[model samples]
Target chain A: MKGKPFFSSVVQKLVIGITGLLLCGFVAAHLAGNLLLYSTSDRYAAFNKYATTLHDMTLLPAIEIGLLVLFVVHIGLTLRMQFQSQKARPEGYAVQKSKQGRGALAARNVMHLSGIVVLAFVLLHLADLRFGLRFNEAGLAPAQTVLQVLRDPISAMFYTVGSLLLGYHLFHGFQSSFQSLGFGGERLTRIVKIVGILFSVAIAVGFASLPIWVTLLRK
Target chain B: MSESINVTLKVWRQNGPGEAGRFETYPLENVSTHASFLEMLDILNEKLINTGKMPVAFDSDCREGICGSCGLMIDGQAHGPDRETATCQLHMRRFSDGDTITIEPWRARSFPILKDLVVDRSAFDRIIEAGGYNSINAGNAPDANAILIPKIDAEAAMDAAACIGCGACVAACKNASALLFVSAKVMHFARLPQGKPERETRVARMVAKMDEEGFGSCTNTTECEAACPKGISFSNIVSLRRESMRAQCSGRSTR
Candidate 1:
């Protein structure tokens, strides 16, 4: 087999790893910022203020553009890799069983299955909250906007499910990104895995609780 | 001495590459349990020959398991039931009386079946040719102390070098990825001082060759590690990724 001049599989994996980790960072930061909505004082005044500050920040557009590029590149490369991997095995075995416990079932298939779910959720989330395209309840506070969109049981359910799926995706994607980047040594890998699990749970519970809090307890 | 047991073998039979294959079952009685798996196959072939039927075809050399030539997917596990053992090392004692054993060749896009239980593993050779070696010449045999490699580094390099290129990892992987095999060779050289000169280019070129050979991308399934006969760790793959990233960032490519 002759070497190709283009991006090798290693480079492709690096791209996926870097972009995936960046997205994970964004999710963590976003969840941390959103956690401010649960503050019991002033009816989420701090949350609205935080949103205004973000909107008013001069670098917000640049960050958004960067995020757009990252999302596009990450998803595109992942789909391409998936297609190539599928093509590599034209005929699968009659019986197959996974022998390794390093990765859980959620981690093994998360790239393909949860990826599509997360992508769809991200689009819906952007439309409902960010762009004000679908659930455009104008003149409401940022917290109220969240409440307005999540007031519908179906929307709340979708958000909750999406958040859970995102957790599963991040649970595997976090440490996996590090592995793809060649981060090793027994101690380091163990720590990274523990951190990955914590991060996944935090993001999932944080995001999922927002909709549940607004819909059920915020009466 | 182990007692003999009667058993039936369900072996995959194919006329040639691209031809449809099917399992052909053969029953034998009072087979010695102490015999190696290949020896059992030899006995079966002898019977087939005596019966005026075509004998089964398989590959094996250096029956001691170091040559990396003997391989078969027995009962859905690569290189049979024993852990860290090759097909040549697996004994019939692992089976029980009246057990039905299924054997097939390494199934992968890059490894086409040449006949029953024999596949074309030349893709591994191509990957090695791509960059699995150090091109440097030290001129003469230098003193052993001249290199002064750290103990940890030397051990790690030796561990990576244990890969036998048997392709069991490929057969076991759900995606049929050759990440473990390629990474073992890449890491073996990348960890030593002598491999530094061409390190960056070697990784890039070998990875390109792996992809060109139609091997699937590694999704960190870790199946390859479990199936490896030489116990080549999955960490080699991580090192390969790291080396590949370094190569890309440094803009080094031998292509």
Candidate 2:
């Protein structure tokens, strides 16, 4: 309407915040499914069966298409925001010092943390889950079979490291998402922050337990 | 104890905008660590006046730091070594004996040098004038609690309002960004019930004024937060963005 009608900073924040939260939700669901690898022998098989049902029986193709759309939008919005923020500071300072304020250092570097999480997800997560899901359709023997796969030194190490990275990303993403959605105020914000911390710890511990249980305690 | 501290002051002296500016050196004797940085300046100014020399020019008022009238770059910093404290509120104890201090006015296109350590920060006022206030004129009285607001929103508004309008944000910023300052004003009123009537107009006008002032955009370097006396949150900037988009798309498209 008035002034600049196209893309603005608010749009950039909204897109980043919403997309980040959506991706967080996806990660939580994925982690829940992975935890089933610790259950009984039939449980792991049933998990794959559910995955097959969702993929072939239902409209999963449509869901993947939707996910693709969201991922594209999120990446596009993040690039624009990065460019604007870069343009804002053309002359870099000699000695740059910043305050922690009421926010944490991890929260301030969401862009950097997200980059790490995405990288680890691609290299390790793909090998363990996505790759297995695609090629090894013979089906897992049981939860113990899934555990045996993860018990490898490399797999366990990557799982432990990757889940930590995910937790770091969620540490900031949880509180930031609420602020972005305009749901944060005094009272709700306090509750949201407590829940955010709890979520971060839960995701970290829940995901890390997979590697630990499989590698050390499973035998 | 009154310690004999040898402090070297390199203060900028400018007769006017068109005149030449130079860093004048002044050596002080027996300066106490208990005195405020401004009080030290006062002592130097008093000596200059007594010796028939023109006192070094600077701006200061309400030394308590709430007025935002006192500000200067000390040792290449917006408000000296202290974090989140105004220049007037900075104590001499932060510095050791024989420390050399460099003081200069805020350097930004919007804040032109008027003289010495005093610059014309009226550009900030103009930005506020552009649309930082409410225009609801009423003839009758309304109940204080007529419109209910959540305590969270009120606290957030107060936090945003804590901005003292000091141009330290511009000085700390490499690009001379006004986002922190502009966002502080925008978020302050937007969070309140009384200011809701002019939310769209305020954002539109304030942002335009900021651009016109030749201030750069927010690159997220976050130096402003480091320099701010109130320690204003960056989330306020994000909040400003959200409100700006909503205002632009709302019914006030024409205005």
Candidate 3:
């Protein structure tokens, strides 16, 4: 991939698409694991067990590192592509109207902006829950840590907003990655689009349920 | 009787490539709703010339949509408001009396404005010259059914062939990407048997040339398809990405 710029240049767009789809897989898996928080019993038996067992794996650190690399590559490559696109048009039109009509959601035009929102949310989420920057959850089970963070009003609200925007990001990003790879037929493409919408909504709603259950409902 | 409407034209005026551009307003009265957008421009130019002022220079040929020669960013919509209509085909009835219409050239790093509403779209020509052709020997249009093409393949190729080399897709794209235009040409060939010989190299070379022309990469906003006068589907772009990937994985060079 080095020495020959053509190799790098040609695959630049492909890298973003491939990395994005991989990250979508990560998001789905993470959502599944987080749903373990809903398994409440006395002292949260199921949730605590799930957390303890997950951390006990020798492959935990390897998985974490691999996830971090995916984040860096997906985010970094897309930003570079956006900047190049900006340079492609030196001047903008005076009053452009969208022809896609209502199909052009505000999210469609601002993938980068939505991406930034998701990134900030991820950083704050890690701080509030995983790293215990906002709450001292060290030596505690992951489920307990999640509850403590979500029970905080400010943190819970942030999570709700963040999850929604992440959904918005995936709303386009989900099928867009498929389009980027050039995979489609009339029926297959339409199916992918519909499924992408469902997947995006499920991920958003699933994550937001944690905050809603912890801070608002269960309280 | 043809209903006439008065319009205020905010036309972008530039002396040359390096010259500063500004909107010069002209109030055109009694423009027939039956007149095409180019005809309105013609009326405006005539009025300007009669007043001893420099007339705005814009591109127009055949005075109809098929040539793909006339285009403008009228009110910021490529070829004006109507869907699947080029500039020459957009009628004045689309606008109301006393409406202010803004007209400008297609803006892109690869498309330099030559005058008021005319742009140097030779970039399209360059892309075509790259590898948009087949090296297979051809004497004449073969007997109608001699080649035995499948109906679906022929239809898809014809759909792609609708692209008229207009730059509206670029003007309307946020990133000024030429993927829609390039994809149309690529798909036009990819869907047919005659296009099989140089399939891999054709896409590889055209895409390389597209990048060299300083066009941006597609972000899948689908704006190009919406603005396309011929209604070229974004599926062509998807097909193009597949074609490009195949070519690259095969270790084919643009050369």
The DockQ-derived docking category for candidate 2 is incorrect
Give the Cα RMSD of candidate 2.
Answer: 5.9
lDDT of each: 0.87, 0.75, 0.86
Residue lDDT tens for model 1, B1-255: 449999999999998999998989999888999999999999999999999988999999999989999999998889987779999999999999989888888899999999988999999999999889878885686787987989998999999999999999999987788999999998898888888889988987788888889998888878889888899999889888878878877876554
Pick out the ten consecutive residues of candidate 3 chain B with the lowest summed lDDT. Answer: B246-255
Q: Tens digit of lDDT per residue, candidate 3, span A47-114?
A: 78877888799999999898899899988888877887888999888878888786435667888988
Which of the two candidates, 1 or 2, achieves a greater TM-score against the reference?
1
Q: What DockQ does each prediction reach against the true complex?
A: 0.59, 0.11, 0.66
TM for every model, in the order presented, reads 0.92, 0.72, 0.96
Better of 2 and 3 by TM-score: 3
Order of quality (lDDT): 1, 3, 2
Note each model's CA RMSD in angstroms.
2.6, 5.9, 2.0
Which 10-residue window of candidate 3 chain A scores lowest in summed lDDT? A1-10
Q: For model 2, what is the error of residue A111's alpha carbon versus the real structure, in angstroms, after optimal superposition? A: 4.0
- lDDT, residue A54, candidate 2: 54
A112-195: candidate 1 lDDT, tens digit per residue: 788888888888888888898878756888888887888878778889999988998888888989998899889999999999
Which DockQ value does candidate 2 get? 0.11
Model 3's chain B yields a TM-score of: 0.96
CA lDDT, candidate 3, residue B149: 84
